[model samples]
Target chain A: MKILVFVKQVPDTDDVKLDPKTGNLRRDGVKSMMNPMDANAIEAALQLREKHGGSVCVVTMGLPMATEVQKKALGMGCDEAYLLSDRPFGGADTLATSYTLAKAAEKIGGYDLLLFGRLATDGDTAQTGPAVAAQLGIPQISLASSIAVEDGWVYCDRDLGDTVQRVRAKLPAVVTVNGGINKPRYATPINIMRAQKKPRTTWTAADLGCDMTKIGTPGSPSSTKKVFEPEKRNTDTQYLTGSPEDMARALADLLENEHLL
Target chain B: MKSDYQGIWVFAEQENGKLHPTVLELLAKSKELQKHNGEKITAVLLGADVSALADTLFSYGADAVLLCENEALRSYSARPYQKALTQLSEKYRPSIILYGATPLGRDLAPRVMVSLDTGLTADAIDLGFDEDGVFYQTTPGYGGKILAHIVILERRPQMATVHAQICSPIEPIADASGELIVEKLNIEPDGDYEVLETRSAEKSGESLAEAKVVVAGGRGVKTEEDLAMLRELADLLGGQLASSRPLVDNGMLPHDRQIGQSGATVSPDLMLNIAISGSVQYQLGMQKAKCIVAINQSEDAPIYDIAHIGAVTDYKKLVPALIAKIKARKQ
Candidate 1:
């Protein structure tokens, strides 16, 4: 079995700050980490490799700094890592991003299974995985809470909001794993040391032979016209101050007066 | 090409002969938009044995219902449903297509958009039309810090998926009349995926999305036991218990009870937040609650900015006290 996982480097959501002037994420001073769900994807891949005896490769499409996420994946027991970074790939929406990833997947051949995190923390679209599967013309199952492989089929427990379905897809398929699928193992000191010497590759749009018209901003059909903070409610908040008991009584009275109790 | 696309279309999602509430909500929203665009509101029904749902669609303001029935589509597998809907879009060329941002829609819409070579804005909070009648899909992105207004400039069938409970379903008209167009499409289920089993999750109480009141706890609640107190309060209020992402990530709560950008968006009549320092992500889910009460130890917690009432006190002490006070008042 050959498994490939897609990872992304996102600004740590807790510490992320926005540029007040531009209304954009200010990544200059913030730290980046593997998207939280992607960690689960990597763990799912590593677990599959452990059970099925195959190599696992992790790929990411972002700036040069995204190689750090690839390195992190390597430390976590992935066999290979690659970063698809190029100027032309910037400003790509879900469609263009998935197209570039599909081209990259074609370049890195021979994978029976492709895995992705359920959704990126930054984009929160959950569209790229299916879009990539569509671009590749392969079947996909998203929101897989659990996965297992047998007889060239990947069985997944899909979380469908109201119900959970056990679905199975044939080989050469795409699966996006949700968080809490498994507890991601921490990289040992030895693995972290060994990860520094592992082979990691970088590919640009030109190197991947991607169409210039379909790789970046020019290729993105939808673009954000403006990004603005949500309008805050303009109600006067009445603050209740005192001991816990006093405040509790005040709240009860307030709710009763307002007919909310 | 531009003139070919007519009417606003909605995917009427149903399962086990039951209609998803969001489908009715979408029909109501489409009815509102139709008043501006002067286009017919069409409901596209796809499933096995779902033709009887056409009347319900009509009552909810669908001018026409396009029924596509196939035994293979009895359960949504993404392939057959996408094929039928895509064929319909290609033939009728709807001016816009709306889908509920449920798990099935999120799974199926993107694939359909790919086949149709169009753009789909997912999880839209609101929809509007421009002067030239292009749809403006507004959605929260970047971890709910910003709202992105998206438009598909070149696509004939503009597509968008909306989160559930964002709009209310209109009252059904008793004598509503509409056309039921039962179309036949030759769709073979050729997908590589197979459904082995399906088990409905056992829900403990009212779901967070539909609850009239929501008592949500955050990391400030200290321990899992504290969450029980919140749950007690929710029960007392005849509502549901919810949590922010950290509690869910910490294994203190289930994913279904999480309220945030990645979790379920809830709009309740009253939201009592305990010890939650509101982040942009969590706020987006419950910001639409009719009234908000924040109880946190920190006086400066951002949740107070949006809350109608604020109590700066330890939840360990305050929650029990409030529970007692409400119990006493009930007596």
Candidate 2:
């Protein structure tokens, strides 16, 4: 079993504070961390490799700094890591990003399984994995809670909010796993030292034979016309000034007046 | 005229022969957009033996319902459904396509976008035509602090998955009529993936969106044991228990109970912010709730800025008293 896992580096959402006046996030000096769900993906791939006896390789598409996440994955027991970084790959949307990743999948051939996180925290659009499956003309199962492989087929139990859909797909299919699928393991000091010796590769869009028109902003069909803060909801909050008991009673009366009681 | 692509289409998603509620909502929204573009509104439906849904779609103001029924689409495996939708779009060449940003929609729409080589904006909150007559999609991102208006720079059949409940479904007219175009797609059931079983959660697992009232806890909830107080209040109000994203991340609550940009966007009637400071992302998710009450120790918490009512005190002491008061009021 050969597994290719895609991961991403994102802003530490916990540290992302809002600018009260501008209504923009105070992104300056905010640190970056591995996307939580993608760490779960790496753990899933590592566990699969443990049982099936093959190599787990991690890949990401971002600026050169994204190598941080690749290094983390390597330290987590991946045999090797690949980063897709290029000047042209900048400003690519899900469509262009998926195309470039698909090209990477072609260049690094013969993967029996392709894994992705349910979504990237930054975009929160779980579109790339499925789009890549479509571009490659392969099957895809998304939001899997558990995955099992047997007899050249993969079975995944997907958690779709109120329902669970148990599905099975053949080998070489794309599967995007949700968070809480498994707890990711931390890298040990010895493994961290050894991971520095592991093979790491960086490929540009041209190196992947990407269509210059389809690999970056030029290939992206969607363009951001404007980015601005959403208007705050129009409501003047009335503070309840009283003792705890009185405040509770007043709130109850308010609810009653609103026909909520 | 933009390569002759014409009209607007909404994907009427269905499960177990029942049309998803979001489809009607999208139809209502498309009707509003139709006024600006002066184009017909079409509801594109793909399911097995779902032809009866066409009347309902029309009643909700769809100018037409493109009904494509096939057994291969019965289970909604991405392999067949994406192909079927892509074929219909290629054949009809609609100017814009809309879908509810549902799990299935998120799964299906992007594949079709790839097949047709188009753009798709996910979870758009608003749609409109600019002065130049160009359509744009407004979606919140970057932790829900910013809204980006996006346009398909050069693509026919622009696509997007809209957030649910952003607009209410228009009133249905019993005698409203529209054109019904019936077609059968030619596609075999995908042999690659097969659905084995499907099961819904127990009734106790109430969805936050459907609840009339939501009692949400955040970092101020203290410990996991403190959740019982909020759950008690929710039960008293005949509602569901919800949590800020941090609670779920802390394993204090399940992911489905999380209410935020990364989780489920809820618009309940009354939502109590128990110790939640309300990040921009959290506010964006629950801002649509009819009434909001922010309760926390700090008076400067941002949650109070939008809440209808606020109390600057510890929720630990306030929640129990409020629950008792509500119970007394009901009596």
Candidate 3:
């Protein structure tokens, strides 16, 4: 079996700093890591490969630096890595991104299964995976908290609000794994060392057979018109001190006067 | 790329034959949208025995209701809901469709959009429209790093899912008038998907989403012992306990207990923040809290700027005192 996992490099959310003037994420000098959810996707694929005796291919489309993410995935036990990086792929929204990924997945070929994180940390749209599946015209099982593969079929326990459902779909289907799907294993020293030597196949838009006009920024229908910090609430600071009883009385008094009690 | 789609439809989400809170909220918001755009709030209720709620929907703001009740639609297993919703959208050709952004909506809405080959904006925080019937939808993105403006042009029934608690429901207009249109889909239920059984987890006090008072903890709480005090204060005040991502990452709390972009967005009436320094990620979640109360030793804590009430004292000291105060007031 050949399983494909899609991943992306996102600015380490903790270290992400907005330029005070521009109110946009400061990308330069900001550290990037594979999206945490995508890491779970890679781990899920790696685990399946371990069980099913298959090769796991990690694929991504981003800037050249995103190749580092592919290396990281390879270190984590993926067999092959590919980076479909090109200037044309920049500024793609979920639709364009999914379309580009679909084309790239076709280019890589020979995939029994497609796995994706429920959503990317950077975008959080959760649209790309299902969109890709739709564009590929394949059955998709999303929000899969747990999955089992047997006899060329994927059976999944999907998390639906306060309920779980058992879902079954044939192979060559796309599955988006939620975070609870599995605990990602840490890469050992040997794996990390071997990963450094793994070659990352680089593909441009042309290699993926993507139309330049419909591959990236221009292809995306929705755009971020503007980015601004949410308005901070203007409030007066009132402090209450003393014993719990006293503080409680004061709070109750405040609440009563404010008509909230 | 403009497509001809007409009417405004709300998916009247129901479970066990009762409407969900989000359905009412959507109807209320849609009522506002209807008045502004000269459109009507049409609701699509899909499930077994769902027509019973059509009267309630009309009271809440539905101008006309589409009832698709079937035994197969009983439990909401995505495939059937997607099929039903897609069929309704195709038949009515609603210019806009609103969903609650609940787990079911999040799962089913996108699939319907995909099946219909249309565009959908998920987890919309707010919705507005222009005179030309173009819907302007807003949603938090990049883990709440930014609010992205989404417009589904060239697609019929510009779809959006509104996050719960962001919008308040209006009291149904007394004796308000609307038409109740019951339409059933002709498709048979595919038993390929089955709900073997359903069980609901017991929810804790005041779901953070609906809680009027919320107390959130962070890494500054130091240890599990500190969380005891935070929990005590939350209990005394009749609120739910929330936390920053760091605490959840550290295994101090579950993901459901985290309050941030990734977890649950809250708009509590009163938010009691303990030992949490405000990051934009955290702030974006609780920014809508009516009155924010912060207890942190740092006078320079970012939380203080957004808090309506704050104490520049150790949370260790503050938590105990607050708990005691509540206890005494009760006595």
At residue A224, what lDDT does model 2 achieve? 86
Q: Measured by C-alpha RMSD in angstroms, how accurate is candidate 1?
A: 3.7
Off by over 4 Å in 1: A14-25, A188-190, A242-261, B130-133, B204-214, B219-241, B249-251, B260-270, B275-291, B296-302, B312-331
User: What is the C-alpha lDDT profile of model 1 across B3-104, one tens digit per residue?
Assistant: 788899999999888998889999989988988989999999998998889999999999999999988788888778888898999989998999998888
- Model 2, A1-261: lDDT tens digits are 999998988887533445767655678997788888888888889999888989998989998888878888999999989999999998888899889989998888899889998887778789998998888889999888888888888899887767788999998899998876787899777787789999999999878999999978998999988677556565798899888888898889888888888
The model with the greatest DockQ is 1
Expressed as tens digits, the lDDT of each residue in A16-125 for candidate 1 is 44588877767786788898888889899988888999999999999998877887899999999889998999998888888999898999989899999988877778
Tell me the DockQ of each model, to 2 decimals: 0.56, 0.56, 0.33
Sorted on TM-score, highest at the top, how do the candidates line up? Answer: 1, 2, 3
**Model 2 chain A: ten consecutive residues of lowest lDDT:** A13-22
- Give the per-residue lDDT digits (tens) of candidate 3, residues A9-102: 8877533446889877677877888887788888888888888897998898888888778778988988888998888888876667777888
Candidate 3 docks at the CAPRI level of: acceptable
Q: How would you encode candidate 2's per-residue C-alpha lDDT over B17-85 as one tens digit per residue?
A: 898888999998898889998889999888888888888999998999998889898768897888788
